[model samples]
Target: MVTDRFNSLGRPARLVALCLLVVAVAFLVLGRWDLALAIGAGALLGWVLLKPVRITWAIFAVAFMVPVTIDLGYPTNPSYTLLLVLFVLAGWGRLHRAERDGWPPRRIGAALLLPFCAVLAGVLHWHGVKPVVVGVAPLLCIGVLGWHLIEEARRDPKLILRIAEVFTWVSVAVAALAKYQTLTGTWPLFDQFAYDWTYTSVFDPTRAAGFFGHPIVYGSFAMAMALVSLTIRGRYWYVPFTANLIGLVLSGTRSAWVGTALALGIWLLLNVRKIAWRGVATGVIITVVAFAAVAVNPSTFRIGTSEPPPTWVSPTEPGTKPSPSPSTSSVDSVGVAGARMSDPVGSASASARFERIAVAWDGITRDWSTVIFGNGPESSVRYLEDVGIGDGQAQVFDNTYLTIWHNFGLVGLLSLLGLLLALFWRSRSLAGRLIIVGFAAQIFFFDVWLWLSAVGVLLLAVALGAAEDRPWPTLPFLNGLRKRRPRAPETSDASTPGFAAAA
Candidate 1:
């Protein structure tokens, strides 16, 4: 009976069955029997469909359905691995097709090197089993995904833009959910344990975590998306740009706000030549409308003045006694009630970021190895551990450039800078330049260099490089001037006395 059943199933059907079996096993291992059953059913249906495009789309959907972020008692999450896998699969397909066609290998070689470099960096930092499995592997995955998208999918700029749009929408939804949780005094959907560490809001009374582990991270992500949206020309472009801007403001992340503003400024400057008059008119209209709105509603977009609990309170401490709940009058006295607070234009947060930058610089200077090669991936945490700095109390290196230099050493830092410089120089269109500049602006105050948020922008920058019209400089040996023969001296049309005689 087993031999007959084996004979009944053809090779393709058997392959499908094997994949289904693997999915079932994975689901069983993860204790998700329902998901396993669904996958099993989907596999059978997908085989019946027999359309390659449909099957591919179904696989993509299933891959995305898998939750990338699972709590494994670690600060880092593996949610992004799913994206990396999808990109790798897509890249592999492209590569296989290219190989079959006997395409020139040099083009593919250049395309693959960036990701290889990133993988090399990851491998060099790999220490034990945990580091290899968790940190380095995940980073390599991201690098491969970035390279795949930039090199393969870049022919369709619209597709890349659509992905950015989707990410923006997702971020908005997450931010809204977070705000809802904050208002209802409920735990956030993600990062439940870190709820108390969130800053309290006064007027709005909400924390803004938009699908990210932290509010600031979400805000920075939104800001980058906003910049990208602004680069696109469309009727609905302003909607995302405005929403993302508002979301960033509500995030109460001072560094993000500053970074966004600076990025926007750079974007505006880059696009000024093309849209100078329209931009001026738009700016004037927005300013006038904003002033009118503020005049009519003084409380709109007011900054919160809620004071943080005393340092001794230990809000995030497990099993710590809660402080005595304050009365309404006490809350009122502390400026927590309906008192409108003026926005502190460039507040203490900005000052604190500057201080952190200085501290990171000082720390890097103290260690020669850190200054040269970087401490290694996520080495700042280890470095802090060596210096007896607790994770909770550790000072953040807010600047991405500083963070990169401190962690990856000079080689990694310069490689990143070179990549950025190449993108900037290669940017031909105004929109492309704006996108690159916007990302560059954020490097001063956020550890964006390591995050997928920045990686996406970097990938987009690389893709834009392909669309640029700039020509490669001629080599000294290949110069046209060097190849051209000297022209013979031209004779006068009307022969002069001596020349005519010689003629």
Candidate 2:
């Protein structure tokens, strides 16, 4: 009778514990650390109710939670960092499983490792241990988590659809938050930032960042998630799909707009045979007509105000002249959406980006050794400050390629480029290839690695893309697109014993 009662209580007890833990973590993220501790203590009472999280589930949890978690502020929020730690711990506990699962496909793993090794070498050359740790820590966490996601998906082909379903729901939540921000002009869960430091249209009320601090990062991520969500074949899937699309537009991120278009185009082209040409043609025609109608009277649709150009006053010389402020006239005249499609040369933001790229290139190439091997991790910020692009209070790089080049030198940049190409080339599914293309396009516009949500989701997308693409009978039309390409002969770095056996 005692055993029966205890067994009957197990599930409800576990549910209560999980709810307590979640609430405690939410409190912690909200900066109610004291309340979090109190709630967390309550959760400890049900410690036996908490079961050990599987490594795969732990990674999925990290991926799902990243979009909602904050990673900024002076002390930095420990919420996302804690998830990463838990993921690492879970993976550590599953070491025996990893030996059988095999390490990340050795080639891609090595490709990913080369840049970190370059960063380590560069940091060591500078005798700065902190930079090395900072560089390697995220890399290690992302790599391990991504490897397991791939392994798990391979083991269960149906897992890919489950992953897509989760992403679709995540997109729905993020999109809903963005819509809320649009309707109310109020940031959820946090106070609105006084200014958006990353973009020219600073403090624009119309641009919704959702949960991520930066609109560009949020928009780019939303685009990727929106694209990934396309794989979902559920009834009424278009509701969330439309929501994500609207969120991406409201983000007012021109680069994300371009990337999404590029990715969508790629996806369509790859699945051209599977696509209904009549429907696509009709949609394209309707879209073109609507665009033409809007183009004829853009002023009617235009809304929002633009602030004056951003100035970077030097700290060393208080009286020194600031760099000429970039013009926001384009933004003012046509609004963010119109300016988004405007010619690059006409926008001061684009011009400023070009100028910065030139300056960064000049600085990076000043010494061949530094150019080839890099000064150290995060040397880009110092170089930017020294060169007078920023006031040391904040360092911003509008370009990920530039930042990577600045931090890890030519070798690191090349390694990353190689890795991207390899991933694209090796991608077995149309959607996987589309995801990579989208991510690659967006990186040219901003430093994507700065935000945990942006980078974490991206790594998840890459893992899904790299995993064996599984066919969904629900989407019989797309089955042709999901067909796996024949495997190439075992290459030293690419072959996995388990993957080979399964293949």
| Top-lDDT candidate index | 2
Off by over 4 Å in 2: 1-83, 86-90, 93-96, 102-108, 111-115, 192-202, 274-278, 281-335, 385-387, 390-394, 466-503
Off by over 4 Å in 1: 1-76, 79-87, 90-94, 100-139, 165-188, 191-206, 271-359, 366-370, 388-396, 464-503
lDDT of 1: 0.50
lDDT of 2 by residue, 1-503 (tens): 95675567669775775688788889988998878876764454234223323444445554445443342331343433644554454456346456676555573465357547556556545847666766655655655555555555656646665666666777777766765665444465444232233322234545777766657767766776777666544655655556567667778888887888998776666555576878578557645543442223223355784344323333357543332233322112125566666676667667778777887687578688768876677677666656666423234567888777777777778877887776666654445666778788888877765456666556656566655544322233443543564554576433332222333
Q: Write the per-residue lDDT of candidate 1 for residues 1-503, one digit (tens) a residue.
A: 96688568789878877877887999899998767876775565545345323323333243322323233332344444444434555455456445544444554554444444434444655644453244345445444444544444334555544555565565556545544543343324443433333323221233444445455555656666676666654456655665566556545555565666776666555344466677779666655543332122122344774443322233466754343224211111112211222444354545566566666777677666657755556556555555632333325566777766766667766766776665565454334455566567666766653454444555555544444333323224444553484543487433222211221
Of candidate 2, the 10-residue stretch with the lowest lDDT total is 324-333
RMSD of each: 11.5, 8.3
Number of residue pairs clashing in candidate 1, backbone atoms closer than 3 angstroms, sequence gap of 3 or more or interchain: 6
Model 2 lDDT vs. the true structure?
A: 0.59
Clashing pairs in 2: none
